[model samples]
Target: MSQGQHWREQLHEAAAQGDTASLLKVIRSAVAERADVGDYTLMSRLLKRIGRDEASRAGLRPVRVYIARSVTVESWLPYLAVEAAAAGFWLETKVGGYGSFAQELMSPEGALRDFNPDLVVFVTDVEDVAGGLPDACATGKPELVRAEVERGVKTMEDMLTAFRHHHRARLLVQGLCVPDPPVLGDAGDANWEASESRATQRINEQIAALCRRLGDAAFFDENRLASRFGKARWRDERMFRYCRLSIAAEFFAPYARALTHSIKVLFLPPHKVLCTDLDNTLWGGIVGEDKPSGILTGTDFPGNCYRTYQRYLKQLAARGILLAVVSKNNEKDVREAFRVRAQDLALTLDDFISLKISWQDKAVSLRELAQELSLGLDSFVLIDDDSVECEAVRQQVPGVLVIQAPREEPWRLTECVMASGAFDTLSVTAEDRARSDEYRAQAQRAQLENRAASREEFLASLQIVCRFISALEAPLSRTVQLINKTNQFNLTTRRYGTSEVESFAADPGGLALALRARDRFGDAGVIGIALCRTQDGTCTIDTLLLSCRVIGRGIESALLWYIARWAASLGANRLAGEYIPTAKNQPCADFYPRHGFRPAREAGGKQSRICYVLDLATQMPEKPAWIQTEEDLNNEPGPSCARVNEEFAR
Candidate 1:
């Protein structure tokens, strides 16, 4: 037998034996051979058999998802689960029967409740919501159209209310897909006043607004996907009418990818940095050999391709992904190009926070970049046009993601990167947009530390300020962002959504504080969060987390000190905290005890949980002299405080 056939046999054996290593080897071999990997059915089967093997292997836990659709979806869910793996998520998928979403979710003892999903997706279409389109020809009045749309939207809202009351799953309602040939034909949207088309559009808009109002719900746009994929090609009349399947089998691949991408972004954190090659990757020619002017760039020929690609990278940087340059070139030449003739270039030297222009290997330079930025290897995306560089980073740095640029049509580079779906996010907090500035400030802080005579002098000279404010009175989105992204400095490592954070703040005697920090270097937006519940004049710390970027600067200790003082003012005499260890949070294992909190309880055997208690009345902890602290009451309250919780007056 040929080598390809032998590899296939080995794959089958590995699948049978449930060997993840062997399965990965087969997939890698297929890529090396430049052969088709087929429909990935064998890989899907292997993944299902391994359950959460990918999560353990990839250093990420699987997201338990329960999908409820108006049509049959079991056949396509496996494909979506595989796609989610690319985003570092292993989806533990469970699907409900056709047209059973409302019944299952609303019922007290239903399959949805038993599954206890982390995320619940309701894949519905126009047919499910619209009881056939309103007769546009019957009445040209806009009032009739508005009334019909409201009726359809009300049904969805009712179902959403039931789901919210029943379970704490993040609800993702699939938007309506434009019907094949659009039942009303070309005239469906004629004169830009088609009642049927207008009603469906209104329904989607209301659903999006409802998600914002609820703070936990999100709407995925299936209508745009169906239109882009060609409504005619997306619909299978026989399957739709007989089998009641709205999405055709052939279109399931992209559809599954879109769904999986949406779900992944909700849980999987996006990359923090983008490292690119300065030579052909960023421009059309090598700057080392091709003189700055001679290099193909600007608004001409192949140069335009590089310009377009550079523009996209700049856009990514603008939204707060740090940019760095790692190239095998002389630093003088690269600097000269960006300095003297920067008007011709879309990217400038200021765009990159770090620049390593040397003859070192790409992997080595990438590691240096990560160290300088104080970010993990898993949080970097290395983009190079050279296949050798890409492969080297993939082999040497296991966690770093490698994106190879398209050499044939350089303009296609942006499309290639975007298609990876790596940078997609549902929300962009203030902290996210300021990440580039934050890292730049960190570099300055390091320089200052080196010049200081002592650590205390360094911190005092830097003049760090901490603002403690209730989450309800602070930026809710930024607080949620820090709570979810922070790992090492997180005590409990429990993630909460916006709505859940609101719920915690709204509960009686529950307190949630978001801490913002600023130093002489720059502002670190909403770097910490503290959630506690008080009962019988005793407060229990539910979660106290700080961003890794702000740690080691005595911020953690200062935060806890302020928490004790705040609790005392609220009439709480006792404070409690717990340390729950995890693979990534080992740095915080002794956090509670180190801060003078005595052990209260311990359990969970191997996964030991240790609790600590502090008497707030007896212990009057002072904020560090080096750090200035204050309660922020100037900003307006967030939506979280608008609930039935007791509002505080200034």
Candidate 2:
């Protein structure tokens, strides 16, 4: 029997025997396997019936997804759930009534609002926009096309506004795809007015712009997705005739794969660092054997593809994914290779945050890189051309996602890495664009620290600056991102949706603070969020989270000091804090105690949750003198960077 057949039989047997352990193992193996759509459908149904809750218990982040669609997506729901499961999310999906999304979104007693999804997906079918086109409207007329565009965008704006009126769930709006045939057929490719494809593409662009204005919304390019999967194959006339299915049954799995790629970002942050192999993975040949002169990485046949691959990596670096080298090669030789080929190279040696070029196991090198960067093993994604090396790293350091780059077929390497979805994110902020530079500065700071005589001297020499922005003044995107992503050094790993974070900012009783830290090296953008509420002359810190990158720095201390002073200003007699124990939050288990708060006893003397309270008048955490702290505060400022009140900055 074939290997896949054998695996499927084993999986079936495990499920039939009701062996939970065996079933979980099989499911893990199956999710990673290249299974057919039919088999995947079966596995998904079984998982839904038996394994979803168990999987959540095992550690899958539970996400509620509501699909607001006018087409038949019920058949596609299993695919969506299965793909989400694979991407470490247990999705409970709710589909709106067929062809009734307008009513569903507008109604006061809407099911879409009732489901309370973490993400609301608007899976746009072409009929959504094109159905409004006038019967006699010529594709050659820009006015006709423009009217439809306005109508479509206006309709979407109205629905979106209504949806946001009740829900703060992040939106994933699917871009509308062109129908099977072009509107003008032979003349379709002439201009924007000449083709339905052009019209849809224009509408998609407008939709993306609208989503960008909405802040928490993302546009999934169904146009590109359909093109990639072949629109010819995705369509089924019989299925559409029987039911309102636009996407074929077989294509639902791919559709789900695409959906999950976007949805995954809503729950989990992308891999922070990319560990790359130097030799054949980055170039077209082994550097040790080929030498610097002979390395195929210039403007040539195979070399051009390798060069294209490097460009892709550079683009990813630009978008905040740190790149590192974990190759079994001589460091000098690699440096020489880049130096010799500087004119044609897309990447420089300085692009890499950590270079583990000694003859060490890639897994060991990755661990060292993790330690050096002060990041967890799970934050890495490694790509190598050797399958053996990839498998070895997978076996040894399973936390690191490993991608096997196509060895001979260099052209496919970029797409393969892109398809891995390890570095997926909905949007990139200014901080994201500066991430690589910030990490490089971090490396410089590490060097400076190694040379410092004492901790005090090191801290003093760093010249760290801590700037506080009030919840009202702070950018909600970064604040919400920090709140959801930071696990370690978090008093309570309380993840909040964007809407809740916005509500915290809007509420008068709540005091939410975001801190931006910068040392002599560079700016580490808003790295901490403290969500607090005041009641009965007491200020309770509901959530205090510091990004792992800036946790050990004195910024957290400075932030606590500001919070205490803010509370005191508000006439809060006591400052309250609580530590909720989580597997990953051991680093912050004693955070309150370290800050001079006394642990308070609960009615049942519950050991799971430890509460602390400090008299604001008597006890205040010492703000680090070495760091210069500033605050724009709660006072409204003009449309500029000018601080409204530096009085709180002392």
RMSD of each: 4.3, 3.2
Q: Which candidate is the best by TM-score?
A: 2
Top lDDT model: 2
Error of 1 at 36 (Å): 8.3
lDDT of 1: 0.76
* Per-residue lDDT of model 1, residues 1-650, tens digit only: 76657766877887788677666556545433432234345556666777675546745467888888887677677567556654456678888877787787677678998998899999876767766455632466677667767777887888887778767788788887655454455664555465566668888898888776665567899888888888777878898788777888877667877887777676767888888887777888877787887777788889888899899999998889888888889999989988766877899899999998899888889888877776778888888999888888988997788888887778888887787677887777777888999998998899999999999999999899988777765577677667777777889988988777877777876778888899988889788888887778778899999888888888888888766655665568898888888767877788877777789866455656788888776675556779877666322233333321222222
Candidate 1 has its poorest 10 consecutive residues by lDDT at: 641-650
Provide the TM-score for each candidate, comma-separated: 0.90, 0.92
Question: How far does residue 404 in candidate 2 sit from its true spot (Å)?
Answer: 0.5
